[model samples]
Target: MGNFAKGYSMKDRQFWVIVMSLGGASVFVFAAMYSVQPLLPFFTEQFQISVSYASLSMSMTTLSIIIGLMVLGFLSDRYGRLPFVRFSILLTIIPFLLMPLTDSFAVIIFLRFIQGFAIAGVPAAALAYISEEIHPQSMGLATALYISCNALGGTIGRLMMGYLTENKSWEIAFLCLAFFGSIIFILVWLTLPKSRNFTIHRRFIREDLYGFWLHLKNPYLLLLFGFGIILQLSFTGMWSFIPYYLVEPPFLLSLKMISFIFLAYGLGIIGSPIANALANKVGIAKIRTIGVLLLVGGILCTVSTSLALIVVGLCIACLGFFTTHSLTSATVSRTASHQKGLASSLYLVSYYIGVAAGSTLLSPIWLHFKWHGIVIITVLLPIIYLFFLNYTLHKKMP
Candidate 1:
């Protein structure tokens, strides 16, 4: 824990401002990142690309964020969090503004690449800021509140874009989102509190690299990190392609109707908190297993051709995704003896790598095998995940 001066309370004006500003920043980060999700179909048609090729629009961003996180994670440590937070929001604005101007698929992907690197600053700083500056008692609630904003942002971005694309051009949809993001960027700049707990340090890259290697060497942390990958792999893979599956074949839904289906992500906001509560009634280990089972079960449900069942399956899968993610994130934070920030960064890197892998690599499976192939591969991941998680429990954390 970083220095938290006495008399600093969650009830204070600064505390609420900090929380709200961070939440607003979260809305920008996730909203910008996920805005393209609903537009993938439109991109495919306009660019005349295959489903697997169209996925580059999303995958490239995620991969760039992985690169950004590695670099920015260290830079934030040296420069403090506030500057990075502000700088990131500002940099992300460029991509949003320029995205609609170009009709070229390559141009859009390039912009998303910039957006990914710019947006990485938010997550890189948010957690460390909250944990260091806020009251220890309030940290959990504050973190949960920020994540809720993330979930809501993702849902709103997809819904708004999906709905707008139904009536207006995709360009109009992106331009409007850019405008909204600019407003949030202003709010964060004006209101976000200056960092009080972080001390800037100019550490060598070799030292940071060694720290990363040491964290990876921890058996338990390594297990949790891998768990992060598996969770995102399954979740992102499903969401990315589900739009394709729905728009075509047996259950043909309009963009507006499919946007409503993404409302299922709202279930994710509740899932983590509910799972946290139930962890008291049921043990954490058992709860984690249940979350994985829910993921597998959700996938199995979607294997059906029934439209109603597919929607239900998506909702169930999202619940599992959020719950398991919350638990594993908490576990990683608790298990680390020091340098929790570095460990968390690595865990997130693993998570996004999963996303990048799932959306890109798994699309080929869909091309070759369709829905059955996607389900079959996703369902198997959770079982392998179970083995790693169980072995981690027995292995013990240092």
Candidate 2:
């Protein structure tokens, strides 16, 4: 047994192992996903491509992530969580190792798409695993910790890579990811205990398709999906463009200096658990409204060129977004009667749909409005989500 696997002595082995292994497991997702964002301008400058064209690195991974979230999440329902989780982790490592070997933008994008697909295992399976295996009282903390790993990894990876890129080639950043992912791979293999809530079944495409369709047919399910979309569109649009905004006029921040901004991501790690605890006390619907309002307020504050204002605003925004995401994700996992894999899948579909659509629409927005336009463009979804959250609060349903 791994040191982590042996340390936590919950009878529900899957639950505690998941809590422990998430730091290692989430590196697969974050290392694969956000590792490239810091390198976007590097690619544009080196390749002599337009900024819009270089943005494809961000776009391709998200587009592929949509396919992974839907397909992988659904398959976990029929085949079982452990197999899907392990298979996805093992497969994802290949693209990380291969990414640094390429010079061609086309090949790198292709590899990034594949990397996105392979890394869907931990997040989708972790959610279903929590809902199924953990006691209801304990699920909130477990979910919060798991999500905190994601936020922490994202912040650290981007900042580390951004600093590294200042001193080395972009290839060095991807290569570093490949090395770290290898260690995480071994840890995940050891630390992910076999799931008790698992049952294997025949894979029937038609029946499973019908199950997913029925799952999505609910108004409440659709509501969750809409919130997921809002969360993604708002969060990703800001993240994808923030480095660009900072490096350009007025701010003119260095890569190392801008990396300091990612320290705001640590607020997400803090906000996740606090938000869940607040939800437990005050109700998720009510807490979620507060979260969205904080997000809007933070974005409004970030429009300034003042360094302190930008840092504070980004910190507040990260907290709000992370809290909102925590509540929404936990709700999706808990609301389902069965086929949580499918429910998780449906939620992620909306999530990644926002990711794809957000990137696609950025071309026109960046052309016309730049960073402010991106903020205004993405803000509407959250604004509408506030209305839905108000409706949910009045009704007081899960």
Candidate 3:
């Protein structure tokens, strides 16, 4: 009984530590994604560029992150998780601090790309680490906690960036992010338990590569991959443009007011873990369908300029996104048994592809359609997503 109590206590402590570490690392991702969002106006004004060029601050970071996810994901298979996670995040520190000093817009973008690349190191490995280390029965809740941290960090990063952007220079914002990243990295190294289940990465010749093809061959894998992309596109499209929509006519909401919408995302941290518990209780697939409906409904709210309605919609949307993301990520991990690391990389790759496509493609929608036009296009996305998800579900059924 004493041994049992000790084991339970140790597990509980490790659980909380991993949770804090994942959440801490996630701030780096949120900082990478949203650090530039509030600074859009500032970048355009300082660099003498258009909204399109200024938005690339977000785009370049995401684009690099995709590369990072793929490359690092692959590397984690050949090497252990910690080295890459540490190397990638620690490397980002220089570029982030440099961001404040660079005079050339081009150089700033290059630095941001490096920052994006560095941020990519954490995700796949973090998930895999938890999956391997945590008890199988606890995997769903553990993964959900990791993802919730991701959402919460992102929510806080964007909100804080916006608040700072209201009063300070864009350069200061990047520097501030560097400070946060460094502090978090330190905390993570100190707190996270050393991997007990992790083995030394064996050299991969050609046979090591087959695991990739093997996972992709599964039809369900293909469907889940596609779903990740569309989900990211929908979420990124909404977030990348929200500042524009809320700050526009009839509303003229300030950057600070727009930042407050991210407060809704705090609710996402709560929703994801809750949703995961519920999904496991009922069924992930069944619970996920409801999540899809939430995504559609939330996007619709942004269509109206009504402040209260949009706010409510954003909260709901945040909840939906976390639910879907947590479920899909867990699905990919469980489904791909042979090379979970590579499988994770692909899921992340698809996810970032959606982000890149959304951030790059939707700028034109904003330019031409304004908010309603953008909403119309985004709304079509979820409608199509529902059809495909349903089609895929039915195929599974019979």
Give the number of the best model, judged by lDDT: 1
C-alpha lDDT of residue 271 in model 2: 86
Q: List candidate 1 segments past 4 Å from native.
A: 1-8, 395-398
Residue 122 in model 1: lDDT: 93
TM-score of 3: 0.92
Worst 10 residues of 3 by lDDT: 1-10
Please provide the root mean square deviation of candidate 3 (C-alpha atoms, Å).
2.6
Between the candidate structures 1 and 3, which one is better when assessed by TM-score? 1
Higher-TM-score candidate among 1 and 2? 1
Q: Across residues 275-324, which tens digit of lDDT does each residue of candidate 3 receive? A: 87898689987778778778778989887767899989988888887788
Query: Candidate 2 on 283-390: residue-level lDDT in tens?
Result: 887888888878877777778989799889888888989889888887887887766767777887788777766655576787788888987866766987779666
- Indicate which candidate wins on TM-score: 1
Q: What are the root-mean-square deviations of the candidates from the true structure over C-alphas?
A: 2.2, 3.4, 2.6
